[model samples]
Target: MKKMLLIFSFIIFVFNLLTAQEKEKAQPTPANKVLSKYTKEFAVSLLKGVDDSMYPKIFKAKMSMETIRKGRNPIKFVYEVYSKGSTKSLMEIVFPARDKGKKILLLDNNLWMYVPDVSRPIRLSRNQSFMGSTFSNEDVSDSTWEDDYDPEITDEKGDKILLTLKAKRRDVAYKQIDMWVNKETKVPIEGVYYGLSDKPIKKIYFFNVKEIAGLLRPLDMRMADLLEEGAYTDVKLLELKELESVPDYKFDITQLGR
Candidate 1:
């Protein structure tokens, strides 16, 4: 009888343990544990603010670029933009000396190729390569960040989050891009760009993070060309200052011809 009682007690204990395990499994994890609070909806809202914060109303920027070609030393091109984004106002950069001295007025989409002998505004397409580099007018056109990219959280793996971005319009360069965002920093660690195919046409790695306007922004970005061997582009953001006020007219393409 005592033996029977012991067996019955052991069975009951096992049954209780199994029930406890089932109950533990049935409990749902907190949403924060399973998914980042920044869902697709939240990312969309955050992106709106992020885009606005990147642009200042009136600002000056200096870009020094090194163009690489096969079997040749890279050529350096230095330029600056004095933009209100209000009018079609731009300044051609004079390099080799004077950090901020020589400035030429560029009033139209036609950028005058200032040669030592000839002086005339040459009509150029936005798609033309700038100084043997992949940078074109489409790359340099003063654009609103809000109009360029939309970040949506699509998936998550462990602590890394995947974000899918759809270009606002076909007039923009990239059709689609996938970003791998850090769960903690809310910043994109890496990005892949897609063209007409499922394969990524370009892979980008961002580093050198610095605080800008209370948010961390990538200071250096390296983009690798998938098609061309040993071809790549590196963009280093120098300074980004927010503008106090900018006229709405700054966004006009007609201003490009001004």
Candidate 2:
């Protein structure tokens, strides 16, 4: 009887494991929003270019983020980031001793935080502030915008493409975004984020463009809180190394804190 029970438990564990892996492979929800300008082929091509330029398929990097407020001293955090494809990423705090050993993971479109003392990881909301920074949790994770938004070409300025993205589903962190993309590079330049009410809530500016992995990529970005003046978080990618591949088990949520 004990052997049968043990086998049953093993089966359950395998089922749960497969379920989670399948969830990570889920496709993007289709957009119901109106797209006035983008053609099917062109839109797909543009979004692909943007995603590719955003980050490499597999990489490990060191980064720093500084949050500056109106009157308070700037708060800084350093992290070692690892990403696999567009779906899995893990970041570990390596600086500001107090936050050391804390980790953040993104998997299957969900965000989680793992602390040294916490028995289990805690699920986090996508729209919530990330460690009290101006950047939202979604801003830190959710790198695959193409999976969550439908694109429309609204306008163009010299050397820039004004692309507007409408959320494909209601659960996304932002309802709409008007982005400025480099015409030649297809990399994002600047963007304004909006909420469900269509009110502009935040803005992001990407800078420090340099060649990485044979493509020009932004190594630094500033996220501005439109609701509060003089509040912004600057994220800098201090080091990056492209990898041919990363071990899949490294992104497993169950192995996160271990």
Candidate 3:
């Protein structure tokens, strides 16, 4: 009878141990929690280019883009951008008399470009170049990495963390990205974008850190196409302000005609 009791007790102890192991497995690991926190911070920093807060907000800014190429006069454009969150945005060119009043709208996965004289807005691919610059249409618009990419901490360097991002879906612009983020600030310092073949196609550097709208962020970005020599795009932020509300019509496709 004592042996039988002992055996029963051993079974109970084993069951409890298994139950505890399962519970631990169900909970998020410390590493996963840390990754989540860092990813959120990084997403906030990325969206900070337009708005400082992660909440739903509107922003207006002046974008100055300069493109340099061999044997050609450098091209420059100035645009006024209105953005809502990281999914909707409208950009209107304000400089260079001929291109004035032209607009581009980004609503979720849809992109449209409206020329002043065109009868209707023309659909555009997100992968298309923005006015023949190194910057793609998707680059100028607002987007969040957390929504499109799965991030993992692959390595740790002194004062920096190396993050590898794989696209969660095939429609994303880049198949994968390797980013070096500042450990202290949780801001991306540099990123290398890769195509489906895992070839590096473009590189981006985030610099000119400053406080804008009461938040610290990188105000300048430089993007270079690895396949092209002596060609790159530089985007500078002239102004950024929070808006109380943006009219719903502002994001409508019909509004592009207006």
Candidate that would win on lDDT = 2
Collision count for each candidate, in order? 4, 0, 0
Ranking by lDDT: 2, 3, 1
- Kindly report which residue stretches of model 1 are placed more than 4 angstroms away from their true locations once superposed: 1-40, 49-58, 83-91, 96-128, 157-159, 183-185, 197-199, 245-258
What is the C-alpha lDDT profile of model 3 across 130-192, one tens digit per residue?
998888887776666666677777667788877777788887888877777776666668888
Clashes of 1: 4
Worst 10 residues of 3 by lDDT: 47-56
Order the candidate numbers by TM-score, best to worst: 2, 3, 1
Candidate 1 backbone collisions, by pair: 56-243, 57-243, 85-250, 107-258
Q: Write the per-residue lDDT of candidate 2 for residues 24-46, one digit (tens) a residue.
A: 55523323343465576676677
Candidate 1 has a TM-score of 0.60
Model 3 misplaced regions, further than 4 Å: 1-56
RMSD for all candidates, in order, please: 13.8, 18.2, 13.1
lDDT of each: 0.57, 0.85, 0.76
Pick the winner on TM-score between candidates 2 and 3: 2
lDDT of 3: 0.76
Q: How accurate is candidate 1 locally (lDDT)?
A: 0.57
Error of 1 at 189 (Å): 2.6
